[model samples]
Target: MWIESTLIAVFVMVLLLDWITLIVHCIVGVGLAWLAYSLTTEAPRLEHVTLIHLPIIFFAVVLGTLANYVTEVVRLEQERAMLATAGSIAHELRTPLLGIRSGAAGLRNFLPALLSAYQLARENSLPVVAIRRSHLATIEGVLERIETEANYSNAIIDILITNTRLPKLGHEDLSPCSMMRCIRIALERYPFSVDEISQIAPVTGNDFIFEGVELLMVHVIFNLLKNSLRHIAMTGKGEICIRAVSSSQCNQLVFRDTAAGIPSEVLPHIFKRFYSLPATGDNILGSGIGLAFCSEVVQAFGGTIECSSILGEFCEFSLKFPRIQS
Candidate 1:
């Protein structure tokens, strides 16, 4: 009886999907029932009602009703499993990544000295041609890029952890912090080739301070750098110039890159969430939320970010934040 009651309830609930339709169905059913009662002197027989047809209708509706509930239950379970797995994976990854970063940092610190010693020994004991100048330069450049990419990868891992664990950005996270410090960290941690690194300019002022979450802003800057570097890499040569200066009421940071710039038609929609360029033959991949994320983060800090570009020439992003005096 309980099972039968549940089935009947499911049937009714399925039929009454919306208020307007439910009302119409209810009025129609009641009118038909009243007419049937008025016409029947004796109680209607099951034989005349056609039992086979009734069972088939009930069977189909009940099947769909239970299937809907089952699908919802499965979907919720899958979401819970995914969240748990993500947390576990982040924890597991952070440990090994920290070790790799430490090792790379150590190599970065001692690499120049090691290279110098090797050069001195080579000159003293062997012919200069034994170790070519171009080979040494290539090795140094490769090592530098490795170190830079290691730092960048660490920052990315940290961001992943933060995204998984941290709550939405709150007012407390927007306390006055050193903008110069964040910018410097972003530059150091951004993945750039040795050549691109050489072209970077210094911050214009010594007094750039702002109010925002340091970590999130770093990600914003990192995102911009990542996008620039990605397009630049496709061409195998590019230059990036970054400058930060204090204005009357705000501090402005300009990042300009001599890379394949965005198209005029595509530029307008670049900041839209999850809107990515179609994969052309070059295979420029993007999550599409990077620029959108940067825009949102800057807005959260009471700032503005704008981009200007000329295709095949350059792309420039200008960010302005209300200057907070120390």
Candidate 2:
């Protein structure tokens, strides 16, 4: 009985809730189930097992029927915690990542000169750790990659945390920001593996200012970059293009990726919150919040965002903002 209940809970949690609630439930449920099992051993086994079965089935039914309510409870807890932090969690993590990034960069810069000194000392026949030819060859790449990974990690952490708090109600936070500059910052800070950035074309010319938060705008760009990359990775053969066009009437940021595009059935619902499709080898079911968050932030900032795609060809997101007079 206990085993059956546990399996049902695990299935519901993974399929519907993504395993977080499983932590609390598994620990508490296992303890309670064990107690029930012990009590069952003392009584008539069949009746006790049947009695235990009722609650578990009820819970499973609730999981199937009230999945959204369960999701709400979890999300409500996250929101409360976020309220307490004011999203400083991202800022808190940044300092340590910055320290690691700085350390890695310093090592990269000074290692070559240190290597030369080590060579001189070896020639002088001083006792030193013998650096192998192979070690020396790979060391520089390692240090550079460390710095890159640190930077990329920091960027991703910021994006993920910030995405949860979209359309931030702080109207006073908006300011005039250059669309081109924001896109550049996002591209520069985004963690792209070797040759990944090469897949992206340069941002189109024509800078325009909009009333927006720079960080929010950068995050919006990051969200787009993430989705595009995920789709391209799924197909394993595609390229990305970002363009910014400005005029008196409208300011537009266009991001296009030649990923084997969204299926017709899934196209209409891409921006729906918490609605992630299942990932099949070459398709677009990501973490589920990215594009939705982008929509929220853009619409919140007095802009509009839209997508157009063709299956097995390409996907493009066009974000339009009111052109602000400089």
Candidate 3:
């Protein structure tokens, strides 16, 4: 079926492209045939040009169509090859990334105790451990940065995997998830710089729980946070707020950021699949799948996601989920 549809599409495109020539050929062929019949026939003689124009029209239509079809076929084949290569590369990179993430987790857990022991030894005046407290503090800071970057890398990998897998959101195990807990975990996992950390919103109500695919909820929140941070980094200062509330029929989570808000013209298309915003000096081009993916996942979980923004002021994303009764 796909092959048949593709062939038909290729034919239609080729015909559209060569329609003018085809029309001219038909007119010429018919006119010459009429002239030839007028000249040669007893009733009306016909000219030899009829023979020339008829074959020309036939050959032009057939050969021109074939050329267009082959060109399209080759272009599609090249695109297919490129996509396959990209998929292969992504697959190869995931293994090493998983190992690095695990190692980083171990180091993050071990480094604190090691630092504390060094501090204790220094306080007791042990000669070998008498390093400056400032030096120890610096090492601790570096370790923290390492852990943060590692988490950031892993989150990026998760996004890539999600994009590649295009995970269908339904039929997963649904579990009761606390909005407040998910927000805290996403913040901890997100790679916020030292100064940016000060701007994070405090967790709100603890009772706002709902049934969801917990891992997916985390990724959705992380994507929102990551986008906000990227925009905020342009101005060197901004705030992100996550507020949760319950209404009569739904539980609402509003994620607002005082970053470079989306332009009015661009705002309407933000959730469109593969539609990226134009890149400016401060922002990198996006794959444009993040928000679309979020929308799909939300819908699959029987929820709705919406966004509102005012350029240069703020952007807000609101997610509403149907509350499940215990």
- Say which candidate scores most in lDDT: 2
Count of clashing residue pairs in every prediction:
0, 0, 12
Candidate 1 vs candidate 2: the lDDT winner is: 2
- Candidate number with greatest TM-score: 2
Residue 284, model 1: Cα distance from true site in angstroms: 10
Give me the displacement of residue 294 in model 1, in angstroms.
Answer: 1.1
To one decimal, what is the Cα RMSD in angstroms of model 1 from the true structure? 11.1
Candidate 1 local lDDT, 77-172, one digit each (tens)? 874565456557766877777787677677878979988988888868855446678888887777556666666666665554443343466677
Minimum summed lDDT over a 10-residue window in model 3 is located at: 280-289
Candidate 3's C-alpha runs over 4 A off are 1-91, 95-148, 281-285
Write one digit per residue (lDDT tens) for candidate 3, span 169-255. 554556778877877787777766787788787756435777777777887887787788778887666798888888778899999
Residue range with the least summed lDDT across 10 consecutive positions in model 2 = 279-288
lDDT of 3 at 304: 94
- lDDT value for candidate 3? 0.71
Error of 2 at 320 (Å): 2.7
Candidate that beats the other on TM-score, 1 or 2, i.e. the better one:
2
Misplaced by over 4 Å in model 2 are 1-99, 105-110, 124-129, 170-172, 191-194, 245-250, 280-285, 323-326
